[model samples]
Target: MLYYRQHFLHISNEGFIEIPRYIQTYLPHHLRVLIGQLQVSSHQLEIERGLSRGVPREERWCPICHTEVESEEHFVIGCPSYLDLRAEFQIEESLQLCMTMGDQWHLGRFLRATYERRERSLQLTHQTRVSTEQTITEFFQRVELHQRGPSIGLTLHQAAAQRARRRSRMVGYRRPQLYQEDISRINTTYNCMMEQRRTTTP
Candidate 1:
């Protein structure tokens, strides 16, 4: 019982792992979910004991390198197909480094590098052709416009000044004219009462 209790505690500790705040701040929802599953060993890796409803039993092998079971550890650290990506991105073997790297934004870079590599591999394997000339042209044009002057037709200083003016206007607009008038009247009455008190004292 004690042995089982200790093992359970160890598993619980591993399962309750918290991702670093910096990693969480930038990770998109989908990537965050993936990371969460990785932490808890709950990802759709073939090594998971139970069969998923729609997936066939034979489909559990690593798609990239068909020699191993598609476990989370195998996909991230041990996969031979991503060796080039691992070298290019300088990715460490530790999964925790994805969240806990201190000196560099390693997690984001690693994810982007891996994704691009995977996308290229898929495109090559499937002979998929996507033309992005228009997209690239538009992006460059926008960049040129930004470099020349404000993309939104306002410089930084101008935008700040506009925001300040809007805020001032909003402050005034939030208070009804009737409420201001009432406040002015109340102040006048209070001053008059103070004067009366002074006169009566003298």
Candidate 2:
């Protein structure tokens, strides 16, 4: 709350806020996810995440900039790497307006492109099986599948297999709960016997 106010010009103070409209209007899932991440400053950018990972405040500077911390403001507007990207996206003004009130679809596309470049630049050190873009693609694939009636795209056998899986999950009793109270009682009895043995010993 205090943090956002410090960095941002517009911070919603209401009890419940609206999900940004561009998310629904935007067709690209990767872009949408990137936009949301950028808005919340929860993306791979150092910002505060580096602090949690034991990075010193001064050392958490942008890998690209090596001047200031990799905060949302720095990544979005201050970094030299994204100078061309900022012009491409028309993000020349306030960071708050560019992110919050600006054309989100355009901004989302910019973020997606920027993130890809960022990923590429950091690939030597930050390698992973699943990239942010891949996760977004897979997420939308599942969502589209569900929206199109779970088994719509599948063949007859695939549909049957899907149903079988659903049935198995729905009907399973799962692992029975191991009542922890029984273990507690056993430990108490053992401790009592051990105490008695010590007392009765010569």
- Whole-model lDDT, candidate 2? 0.71
lDDT of 1: 0.58
After superposing candidate 1, which stretches have Cα over 4 Å from the reference? 1-34, 40-59, 96-104, 123-202
- For candidate 2, lDDT tens digit of each residue in 108-167? 877887888887888744544346545544553445544654532454455568888874
Candidate 2: list runs displaced more than 4 Å.
1-21, 124-202
- Using TM-score as the measure, the top candidate is 2
**Location of the lowest summed lDDT over 10 successive residues in candidate 2:** 2-11
Error of 1 at 145 (Å): 50
